[model samples]
Target: MSNLNSLQYFIPELFLIVAILVIIVVDLFLKKNKKIVSAYLAALTLVVTIFLAYQQYGYSPALLFKGMIVLDSFAIFFKIITALSTLIVIFISLPSFRTKAEYYVLLLIVTLGMFLMVEVNNLLMIIISMEMVGLISYVLVGFNKHDLKSSEASLKFMLYGATSTAVMAFGFSYIYGISGHLNLDVIQQSLIINQPQALPLFVAFMMVLAGLGYKIAMVPFHFWVPDVYEGAPTPITAFLSVGPKAAGLALLIRFLITLVAHPSAGNAANFIQNVSIHAPLLLAALAVATMTLGNLSALMQKNIKRMLGYSAIAHVGYMLMALVVFNNQGIIAVMFYIVVYLFMNFGAFCVVESLTDKLGSEKISAYTGLGYRAPFTAIAMAIFMFSLTGLPPFAGFIGKLYLFAAVINQSWYILALIGLLNSVISLYYYATVVKVMFLNRQENAPPLRVALYNKLLIGALLIPTLVLGLYWSPVINFTSRSIGFLFGK
Candidate 1:
């Protein structure tokens, strides 16, 4: 689509851009409750943006802005995901970041970056959007300038982000040198027609994967995750855990199917036929290592946020299992799992943030006798823990079931078994959190008071986590539909 035609379909982003500016202007004048008012405005904007995104779902998919981006269901789906996640992040920020208007401003800016992250269709947009998100994230991570850990995490995050993106851009140069194009579709055609040699193309592909993997916190590229999660403000840590990670996965899936893999007849499957890389063999290795290392490391973490950070890495590995097959079913599994994970992971973090606000601690020991002190929140935390462990009658179990089934459908039975065993290993650490909360006794501990929104927010996240487990067909069908345009069906 041309620039003029693209604008109509891009209303959600336009509204967001306008709203961000308005909020900044609004913040400048207010002396009282400035951050609260700005956050409320940001949340309102996201609600409207989510509505605008839904409207685009009915629009026919198009290459917007002269192929710079694609307006499609897949992109729309992620737009809503990132926006909605950030909305929750805004509310959560009221506790730790409500005093500073810059926190809300930076958040809105990073949300814009994430919006562009999913819709990118050109190789250059990848670098542009990613750096936009990365730079803002560094600022947000270090927002608590007084905290040494926060400052340290920000520096490490910046270094890792810069290195991966530079390597990935270098890889993109090699790709353009070979394919002579920057647009994903054009690059795909060029590579298919020219049939580049195996070795160089494979190396270039891995470099790009390293960049995407780092964003999603895939192992080896995941060195920054634990520290970043622990040191950043709880709200920002929660945002980091979900928002950018989902965008990275969106880009990864689109990049793989469009540039490396070919959509099979009738858009029924995706396979790396044109590209010479052994994606399945390599992805399987990463998945195994990511999960094993995450689960093992998580078992030793004393801080709740750091444990969830490693746990986030483990969940990424689980999602990667579906991609080892790289079929339409696998795609649906990944998309569904990401949604399931958003609620479970955020709920766990929410519980931690809420309690930490009152207790001024993030350690597991602080949660002793939580069941007696804060029964409702403790129970909610237990549900999140159980769901995270992929237990029965929760969204996480259903999500994992779909992923395992997808891998099995391709006859990758051994890989599926390994994933199941890893799930068992994860159970120990997740259950340990529950055990500490309810089983360990702490006499005369003070009663913990949770704010009204925190209580309501946990219920909001909890409902979907449990209901989706019982009635997940709607979401399954929705995810199946969302990828239609990705494969041009």
Candidate 2:
């Protein structure tokens, strides 16, 4: 009965579950008319869930379900981001995926899973939620089954996801066997006590990190990204890049701050600290490699989507550089970067979706002479590309500034310099898309028409890119407070 009483603490998740069931039931009855119902329900559910999350803002943390989950500021922050990002993705998808209603259902489940990913305190719950999210994404990636590209994307994503899951499970088994604890906090405690036996522990943790790195598409584990992104539908690609990436980062954050950074472990603690310092080096190397590789690969791509796919990988490297810092500033910078990334990446995809739907082409040359045909969209794409390349007067520039600043503050000067250089290298490819849009001349390019709903969505995203770029203080402050609140500071 006492454990049951703890239900009060799980209102956000409860609301989400109830909403999912309601949406599912509604879909069962509505048949072809189901998407409208599902969309509204999903959006309303997320809004209510966000409200519930806000209600828990000042509440003390409480463990529930036999200590498998805990509500804290960190979880709440990610929950809110998950909910909001889902809402945005649903809107973004509406114009592109109206023919496929299943996206609504899959997206809701994925969002719920991501929310759970943040709240779980135990490895079992984390694995369950992580897999739940991954499965939904696999479906979403290939939702347009008629498209051979979509099918290929789905297959590649599923194969990679399965392998990563198996690796993670294997690593978890080692962690449990070695530490004799399933709860992350308890496992951290055990690792500290067994610090003298560090080799086995480091190996165990690295395996787990390797699995997570795959999810985030970090170096050595990022090979599948561009193929999957290019092959997936535009809206689904947007969700894949932003939603899962953010969830992966949230899980990574939970693991690092709670599990690996515990102070009681002598050698293990030192190992983590060394990681904090050397992480920049590893990420710096990865950053240089990823950005150069991604850009160089993107340079040869004719498909616009594939170009963005490689660009996303390079962006991952940048985000990882911030992660390499592993401090509060770095964490806040990461969260901030995600917000900007969502707008910039989604905006770019919106343009892609709009253009493809209208022009029936995804080729880079298809954008030739498009500036005169679709002035608003071309201009928007230019802005997004500029932002993506970290140019001034855009949020991407600010995001990169803060990220580099955080890295340098940690005394990772070379990492900072490498990041700066990568940004410059990235500019060329990103500019190539812009050049085609504005400078290239071609024959027989038709006029582009955008839906009213899409125009509104694009305009809505544009406001944030401009606002956050010039006035980032509020976001930085909120994110900093959110980070401090995570560890109960």
Candidate 3:
């Protein structure tokens, strides 16, 4: 009977699957005008999933399938974020995909993949979930059918994603062979027993990191980011930039804290000693490279979406600093940063979506005189850009502050310094977008009629950016508590 309770733990995911099936049935039966029903069904499913996650909050861990799936605050938090982000994506996509039915279906599948990515404990499950999401995203990116650029982008994304997945699978197979267990906890326990194998273990770990890094678009593995971003639909680009990115980060936390840690007592002793000597140095390099590469490339971008693409890579560098700390505070800081990033980023993408639909303009220069022509969008966008730049009195600044503090607390002063310097460099390009909107002058720009849905969505998110600027304590506390549940350390 207690085992049955474990099934209840997956209520949110079960709800999502049922929602997907219902939407598919409705799509089959509904004709013409009835097609919009799928969007509503998608939205309803997301809302219900969020509600289910909320209900599960503050509960003790509920383990399922001999502990392959654990229902805890950490999973619940990511689940909620994924669901909310998907809901908003659907809303934004409705106008973006007026004629495409497959777009909504693909989105549903991606959401399923993301939900599983955050909750699963087995490495194979993680890879499978990632492939599911990656496949759907590739299709969505090229769904325009007539656009050759879109097709090219989809092909690149698929090839890159497939190669990365294969690399990760090889790494997982090594871990399973070494430890004789697929569960993360079992692997962690095995590492504790065999400390001498650190060299081989680290190699496998790096390979796995390589694959996950590609998903997050970290430096070196980030080659495919800008092209894919530029070629995809504006709304789909926004979704990719936010949804999968966050899910990937979430899984990184789980992997780093659970699977990477040594499990046996004597092995753990040797492992801990070596990690302090080598891990920080390795992460520091990643920090410098990712941020420098992303910022330098973003400076040359003509398309606003592609620029944001490079910017997202740089942003990952900032978040990566927290992970380098590898402690409770670092995890909390990263969680908080991701939460803030979702708002600031999705909000920025919303502005791009609004402008693209309104003016049919995507070039950076197209934003000139928008401050006067579309005051609300311009102001909202300016706020998002400033937030992205880590400026004062914005959520981005607070997120960065906490992340830096986490690094400093761990005595990784060098990484904290590099992260701060990157923020300074990032501000230059992020500010350029603001300058294009308000500082650059143009005459007789046409008026843009902002859709009510877009307005409501942007307006809803702007409050958090402003509020977090002044009162970030609650968010920090919630994130810290959630991280505690995640690591139990």
Per-candidate TM-scores read 0.97, 0.93, 0.95
Best by TM-score: 1
| TM-score between model 2 and native | 0.93
Instruction: Residues 1-489, candidate 1: write the lDDT tens digits.
Output: 789988987888889889988988988888875557877788888899999898888577889899999888889889989998899898777877666777877887888899899999899999999999999999999988999999999999999999999999998988888888899988877876777878888888899999999999999899999999999988889999999999999999878876567644232234546567777888889988888889889999999999999999999999898888887788899999999999998998888888886877899888888998899999999999999999989999999999999989988888899899989988998888889889997887878888888999899999999998999998888788898876668
Report RMSD (Å) for each prediction in the order shown.
1.5, 2.7, 2.5
Q: Name the TM-score of candidate 1.
A: 0.97
lDDT tens digits, residue span 144-170, model 2: 889898899899999998898888888
Candidate 2 clashing pairs?
none
Show model 3 residue runs off by greater than 4 Å.
Answer: 1-5, 262-271, 274-277
The positional error of residue 42 in candidate 3, measured at the CA in angstroms, is 0.6
Error of 3 at 287 (Å): 1.8
What candidate 1 gets wrong by more than 4 Å, as runs, is 265-274
Model 2 steric clash total: 0
